[model samples]
Target: MKHCGKGVFLRPMSCDIKGVENLSVGDGTLIPKGCTFYCTRAELRIGKKVIFGPKPTIITGDHRIDIVGKHIIDVTDAEKLPDQDAPVVIEDGCWIGANVTILKGVTIGKGSVIAAGAVVTRSCDPYSIIGGIPAKLIKMRFTPEQIKEHEKILNER
Candidate 1:
């Protein structure tokens, strides 16, 4: 689906995007095929110049497994578990690799790289590189000097 100067390449088997009103994909963004974007009761805001690899899942729903597991005998309610419903914000200039799963209430900071197949459970810091199952910070995108220069330019603006 094309929207607002952005190109979204959605696969035929892509998961349904709920809460379309609350989801925003910015300009010059690309969402590859076979990805799942769930915007359930929370906003999903994607900034400009973002790229999503194939089969990526951005989920905005987290449940209490301990409480739900005990008394939720109903099979239907099992999948309908309650979530925190906080928004998932992916800021500008991000490259999200294939098969990544971003959980609820997480903010992926600007200019960061999320490696392929990483499961992001918490928030990420800007200009950082994250990988692995829980998404550890591997390194910063810029050196200290470069970061200072960048910040100086921003301060002037």
Candidate 2:
């Protein structure tokens, strides 16, 4: 937890944040134990009041495999390989369950809930409840009217 906002709670041994310069955790975020954040050569922006369960892994970069008859590690030239580095954004008030893996270029919208052991590879809508290996949208947390009402209440504060 190199860069974090106010009142952010990070339990001991909870996070292994690579590339501390590229990571930004917002206010009131709670990161429990065994969480890993890999932000090598990419940016990870987590918004306010996000809650992360145990052992969650957020990866912001991957090795590109485009060469034939050559081991991926053998290819030393970075320019020859495909670009796998991308930013990962989690909007305000998301709850990421235990052992969840969020891949690169994913933006989780506000108030979304990611189920345990889910592998998230894409963006989610606001207030979505997503689950499963590929992390499909199970349902919205609230109806449109309810969301509007909640937003109104938040704005009043």
Candidate 3:
């Protein structure tokens, strides 16, 4: 596996990371096998204590399917098209489940939990639990009072 900088942990038989640069991993992070983290033309800023389950695909590009009618082409031709790339940011302390697909331009907030096989299409809020095909906010990780307490602690640090 290709490492851009220090602090990235790759398990045995993990896929290589291409086009990634200027990356920093905090202490106690674990990236499992068969997971592909591609950061082409984008910066993937992951924080401390993040955990990635196996076979999680984090993609930073999506193709434009804006070809109007009558220009219909074969499936192979469509696959050769260039994708519009964007940055994918997963904040600190997120627990991403296995086989999860995180699409382009998505920012998963800190302390969020993403369930397995979920397809995240949009940004998720901090301390939220998300799951399903198109990932939805299932619940908050903390109560309002708990959140306030955490924020207070963070502010003091």
Candidate 4:
């Protein structure tokens, strides 16, 4: 593990992470090649046993889009529009597929599977199978009985 000032780069797999001080990753998380996380003004929390495929991008900030004809990059520091920034939370045991882009203020629930090339822009229930652009819920990972049992166990904790 290489520690660069305030940022801690976990060994074995490298990632491009902005605002590393606002990021926290759980143990046994496997971040494969070409994974990027951009966190600004908010904390990005990733839980344990999470697996990320190649070229997954998790961003927590979006530029404003109120000014007409003016590019977002050009309007810097001047009062134009408010930026949308929120924390991203990825719960434990998630299998995020290749080239998935997770946007701001999204909370991926535990034991969920996100399909390849999906764009996730919202929160999800636990054990969900999400896919496609904007990332709709395809199905639940567990059966009704299994979900009940899981919820029972979680309630005890």
- Single out the weakest 10-residue window by summed lDDT for candidate 3: 70-79
Of models 1 and 2, which has the larger lDDT? Answer: 2
Model 1, span 12-68: residue lDDT tens = 455566666778878777878777888767788888788887888887865544564
Indicate the TM-score of model 3: 0.76
Query: In what order do the candidates fall by lDDT, top score first?
Result: 2, 4, 1, 3
Candidate 4: regions farther than 4 A off: 1-14, 68-70, 77-83, 148-157
Q: What is candidate 2's lDDT per residue for 25-85, written digit by digit as tens? A: 9999998878888886789999999998889999988875777887878766454433578
TM-score, one value per model: 0.77, 0.90, 0.76, 0.81
Tens-digit lDDT track of model 4 for 33-131: 678889867678888778888888999887776778888787654443334778899998899999999998999999899999999999999899999
Model 4 per-residue lDDT at 102:
96
Return model 3's CA RMSD, one decimal: 4.5
Better of 1 and 4 by lDDT: 4
Clashes of each: 0, 0, 0, 0
Worst 10 residues of 4 by lDDT: 1-10
Cα error, candidate 3, residue 90 (Å): 0.7
lDDT for 71 in candidate 2 is 87
